[model samples]
Target: MDKDFWLTKWASNRIGFHSTDVNPLLIEYWPALSPKGDEHVLVPLCGKSEDLVWLASKHQKVIGVELSEIAVRAFFAEHFYLPLVTHIDSSHVYYEFDELEIYQGDVFTAPLSGVDLIYDRAALVSIAPSQRYAYAQRLCSLLKPGGRILLITVDYVQDELAGPPFSVDAEQVQQLFPGMKTMLLCRQEADQHHPKIARQNLTRFADEVWLIEA
Candidate 1:
């Protein structure tokens, strides 16, 4: 997908994928992963998620990489935070808000490392299938040895609908991140009552959650 597609989505206020509440799945499944306080957590393609705020309170530092500066600023502004800002480079800006460190830049190129845990709620399912493997590689590379990921993906028949939340099955995930230890933490029918499903004409959808370790 073109980078501008997402930038335009933010520009035009078409981010239907963004949720109004912290994802319930994250809340229910995260503690089982056994987070040690004071570890670094990276959230890829983080879009001003309240999850970051929640995470900051628990972890030593919460790092998020996003492409939209608007989203980054709105995140702190909406929460009534005044961040200490710094320009990382031409492509990146850093905002230090409480324990949250949000970087506005390309997720693929961010100087991200030493990530003890990764929270990937929307990143995986939000891109084209052709990019999924590379995305997984980038995600895994950010971790230290034995680092873990809390991942969520969606699966559906391609012909049934188009998507930013594209269908990615178990086989596809394994192909993308070979040799990783993985456990299925949750699998259920996606909320069919979601109003967008009717508008998109989707026939079916399934949500899958995984705990992945390198």
Candidate 2:
């Protein structure tokens, strides 16, 4: 997807991908990773997700990278926060409640260091297929050794539809991070009866939760 594609989505409020609540899979598997105090967690392509707020409550520093300014603003606005804004290189930083910081720019172009954990729910699969490897390399580079990543991906037939939420099988993920210790945390078929899937005419969809240790 191009920058204009996402920018238009945010501009028109066409964000069906944005969940209203924290993801249940994250809640279920996060403790297994055993993140410690004040450790920084990175959220790539984070589109004003409520999960960041949930992580912040656990006393973890949350850093989210988003491409759209509108989505970034909506995150703080909807949460009733007025973030302390600053400019860092080509990106804009929005810090709020002393726990969360969102950077608005391309994730590859952003400067980041000291990331201890990664929470990837919709990020990896959202990118174009050709870009997934580059995205994974960038993500792996940000992590400190012994750090972990909680990655979520979808599996389905891609010929049926166009995607901002693309389909990525487990093998591709393993190939992306070749030497890392990757484990399949969970795999469950998504509820096809739901209105969301109905719109897409998706016959089958499955979610794969992965734990990556460096």
Give the number of the best model, judged by TM-score.
1
* Cα-based lDDT at residue 39, candidate 2: 84
Q: What is the lDDT of candidate 2?
A: 0.87
Q: What's the TM-score of each model vs. the native?
A: 0.94, 0.93
Q: Any runs in candidate 1 off by more than 4 Å, and if so which?
A: none
For candidate 2, the per-residue lDDT at 137 reads 93
Error of 1 at 77 (Å): 0.3
Write one digit per residue (lDDT tens) for candidate 1, span 61-90.
899999998889888889999999999899
What would the per-residue lDDT of candidate 2 be over residues 13-41, giving only the tens digit for each residue? 99988999999999999987898868899
Candidate 2's displacement at residue 58, Å, is 0.9
Model 2 TM-score relative to the real fold:
0.93
lDDT of 1: 0.85
RMSD of each predicted structure: 1.5, 1.7
